[model samples]
Target chain A: MSKLLIEDKEVVIPGQILAEGMDYLPSNGAIREGDNIISTSMGVVSLSGRLIKIIPLTKRYVPQIGDVVVGFVKDLTYSSWFIDIGYSNDAVLSMKDATSDFIERGADLTQYFSHGDYMVAKIANVTKTKAVDITMREPGLKKLYGGKIIEVNPARVPRIIGKQGSMIKIIKDSTGCMITVGQNGIIWLKGPDLKNELIATEAIMRINECSYTQGLTEQTEAFLKERTGGKQHGVHQEA
Target chain B: MAYTKRLDGRKLDELRKVEAKVGVIKTAAGSAMFRMGNTIAYAAVRGPREVFPRSMAKPDTAVLRCYYDMMAFSGAGERVRPGPSRRSKEISMVTAKALEPVLDLTEFPKSGIDVFIELIQTDAGTRCAGICAAALALADAGFSMKDMVCAVAMGVIDGTVVADLDKAEEDYDKGPVADLAMAMLPRSGEVTLMQMDGEASQEHIIEAVELMKKSIKKIYEVQKKALLEKYGGVKDE
Candidate 1:
């Protein structure tokens, strides 16, 4: 009785059925009923072997473990700092998880992470209610400065990063901009000059506009090359 | 009584005309300009983003705010003022209520999903058209929902049950009679919103509801076509 109602990579909306029975295991965007697997959101259906799932078209950032995010320092608590990751609930950055050095218990929390500073941190844990705990103790994770952060659709972040970092590698080597993309649709770009920064930003927005299309990497690579006058024209296929 | 002809030359139960296009406003996440008969409504949806005014932020779910406006130039005769009035305010709330049941707002908490609908040219039944357009814009913005909502108005005109009444049919003098608007989830046959003014007998009300169900099925096709046209959801070869 188990059957897939949608083709591979077919677009589906909420409440649509993906399967009719228990033969297929449901994943993201799917809810299991007594014998049917139904879609619970608007997304593209993808089947991996026997695993059936749907990739949502629009959604909020659901923090996962080890996700890099751009967060704003919203408030300062007595013992912990609250970070607004642009999602629902604010994430807590305990003073203990702030750094490796032995900082005093209540020794100037703002000086460590102020109320207005922007930081590039990693999600250490995500609770059931979507409350995240971030950490700056990891390498390459710190408070960002002198750079501009732009927002795109978070659902398209995977295409922005490209497969195995191939797409981003082209962007980095081409523009010579220090680019870091967070899973939460925030991109931090720092370049030697504003021209390069603008180029990177425009490129990212273009990718965002057409993220769902095929051959996005080639289009992005070509866009960067033309904008930069082929100075950094080296298109590396996805690794 | 062979009075089957309507003022607009439609049958006793014929829609005027429905034309829609999504993504009209490039800046907004999703937007649409929809016209039913001569009444035109534009809807734009922008967000799952940060909520302004810290007080309105929900701790566990997202907030939906709708604003309905009627431009001064949209009316037929004299100029209408461009601002929010009591009528527009009420229409805004009812329009939001019609489509609210479709969206799963909890998916984005501490944020706001803002929808703006403007009645540029209204000749009656603008709120129903606005709700229909709002549903299209929401889908175009990629927000998932249980089912898309479709709406239509049914009224008794000249002692005849009709669907999608125009301003002429609605202006039957003697203090407007029995104007009913129904917004429903067509597939599941659930009415999420219903507004009635004027008067009708019990039997006529039942007849109007039945007539509304049929028109909704047609309008539902138009709504889905508009979404698929923008998003490329064609499965047929």
Candidate 2:
């Protein structure tokens, strides 16, 4: 059986056996070996060995074609709005790709999208010369307002969201706040009181800090209770 | 105008406080974080990986690739977007060239070296800061080089040439302010990379170069001091 290191993490390629007699894999603090296999790139592994595969992380946010993200309108031109997607160049949101609703000519663009107004968008195209175009026509894509935004390392976004939305659901339920996480590392939290908003922010921060751990839902729930002087209410208990 | 004073109330040739640390990231093969005045930069050097793209790969020497990025939160006022801009791309290219003469790329045949510089906070002269930080990181990663390339920026403002320009001083646009940034081999007194912007007379340019020479001398001392502190003064030849 052939085994190789993918990104410095030991992984058994599909149709290959993880080296025998090797159970404990070195932890680089990102991923651990012997973790249950979830998805495979190609074929399934036949032999059992504790091997962990690592995913490369990046600090800059590059817009891949067809990636759904949320961004803020930084500048408005005659035909498009320059969207700040936390990338080097702002993504272009053309009028054709805007909402279906009618937009007036020469009207104050702020009425449609003021500066700092957030909107969920999809990367439609990226040119070879580094022009990025975005669209807001997809379902559940709209402008975001009246929320407290928190930023974190974009690489930890998937970990903060958790599997099947369980972690975010818990935070929303416990704090009674509406939370929306943009894939580009922008998190919006809106609640009645500043206290709940702070709690939600702290919870998200905690998730970002300890993303590798299991049983994070229970840990987050307990953390919320400790921070809020007891359960506030509307916290859903998973069956 | 030749103002006989420093912007930070120090002497004309006084440099801002400089601090450097190595091995900041355990994951990276070599890493360093450095601060000059208010500017902060971090550098990580990785690889001896097989060259890619086939065409750019060198049979006799290892290729060097550099990525210099400025964090959005590094500057005050409006935050910048992450990733490389045109200016940063130019800086990265120049920095790679600055170290090219020093590195013994022949040792790693058909391989490449990657230097990644992240500007955490920028005041002024981030390129120089990045070069200094990258050199330390390269050394920390056990890469052999002839001599460390030290860089510094000097500028002429208000008829007076300053050794190091701060943010405010750099932004002053009233006069024909010119900036001269250079990377030099301290021991050999060889120029590795040099660039000048704005308008300056030949005399002013020569004066700025002299100032940069002095500033780089001090910077070289600091660089050696930092390495000695980290590696116990081994003084790798």
Candidate 3:
């Protein structure tokens, strides 16, 4: 007989049995082993219809195509600039994808994107060997200037963004920071002053920590309200 | 004369008191500390990040590197010399092999997962303790693992099979001392590592394996509790 071994939203570690028998299917952080479906990572169990999946608590960033990422320029070659996007493999941003400007052959690529410069780009392609290629040809995608970056656990990014971007909107409106959250968990915040930016950074970090708890949106709103002195403080300042 | 009683006044099949904690190191990707009796081991796991000496990285799978070291004051009888020694090198290799079976690293190809284990105290079963701590840290890091690895040192003293020998038991001079360290996958009861020193009879070796399996179940409970405690998974009884 088919049996459900665990309840939904229950935290399970690797090798913990989620279900027994062939009635259930395993996916994403879970796997089938013989007659039982077992979790392959430390995560929360999610039971959807006949499918069993695990939502991982913590994991490194695995780059995917079309993911907006904030990265730093690490090296410059004649035709491309290498960016470190917190992935194991450095992402390559070639000349044509780097900008809309026409360029001569073997031109100095550093002029367009210099080392230590932070930029927001989207992944264009990833090879079978995990070689990543990023692009900046899209709108709102370009080098970021004078904003500090902070990283959170990549798995918690979805919660930070929240449903319909409401959670991030609360933080942005209160701190008055121009926040750009990359899918890889690297976040950039530029505020009217360093103090405002630091407050926003702290808020985001707090959200990242309590992402798994219930009533997160309300908790975040309360936190932002207190930090901004119960009002939108930097709305008048230039971002 | 027969070794009817344990040196520490414990049952013959009993194990040392085990204490386990996870996320002990703030900077490591995953870190854990495991203590069994007087032997304590701290393990930290880093990466699926870049692998140095790029040539050594495997294209199809991540390299699992383990470094096992004993601190200068960790040794029971004498102060351990700092740095890699012949014994430590061998232990490191074995520890890696013991943990390799449970880890699935194909998704992180061309990278490295480095596990650094330091023994802050020692009585016996140092390698086994290190393996247990490393397994917990790997789980804390959210790596894909088939099962947890639990280990213990089983030995024969004066023809009596014993589980979890401490320094005094290991140094028992009344009879031939046989020290056998084993690492097993708790679920399947598959032996991933089994190293023996000294000598034991065929019957005693078989009995030791059975006792090791039973002892492993207890260690597995501690490991599960440690990982779950970190994420607040434990429910009130």
What DockQ does predicted model 3 obtain?
A: 0.72
Give every candidate's TM-score on chain A. 0.90, 0.72, 0.96
TM-score of each: 0.86, 0.49, 0.96
How far residue A204's Cα lies from its native spot in candidate 2, in Å, is: 36
Q: Which stretches of candidate 3 lie over 4 Å from their true place?
A: A233-239
Off by over 4 Å in 2: A1-239, B234-237
Q: What DockQ does candidate 2 have relative to the true complex? A: 0.03
DockQ of each: 0.36, 0.03, 0.72
All models: lDDT?
Answer: 0.80, 0.70, 0.90
lDDT of 2 by residue, B174-201 (tens): 5667777788877556888888877788
The candidate that achieves the highest lDDT relative to the unseen native structure: 3
Could you give the fnat of all candidates in order?
0.29, 0.00, 0.61
Question: Model 2 Cα displacement at A173 (Å)?
Answer: 55
- In order of listing, the candidates' clash counts read 0, 0, 0
Mind giving the per-residue lDDT tens digits that candidate 1 earns over B72-142?
88887889887788988898888888888878777676778889998889898888889988888887776
State which candidate, 1 or 2, has the greater TM-score: 1
In angstroms, how far off is B186's CA in candidate 3? Answer: 1.1
Q: Order of candidates by TM-score, top first?
A: 3, 1, 2
**How high a TM-score does candidate 1 get?**
0.86
lDDT digits (tens) for residues A15-77 of candidate 1: 566788778988877777567786766678889988988787655567889999998899988
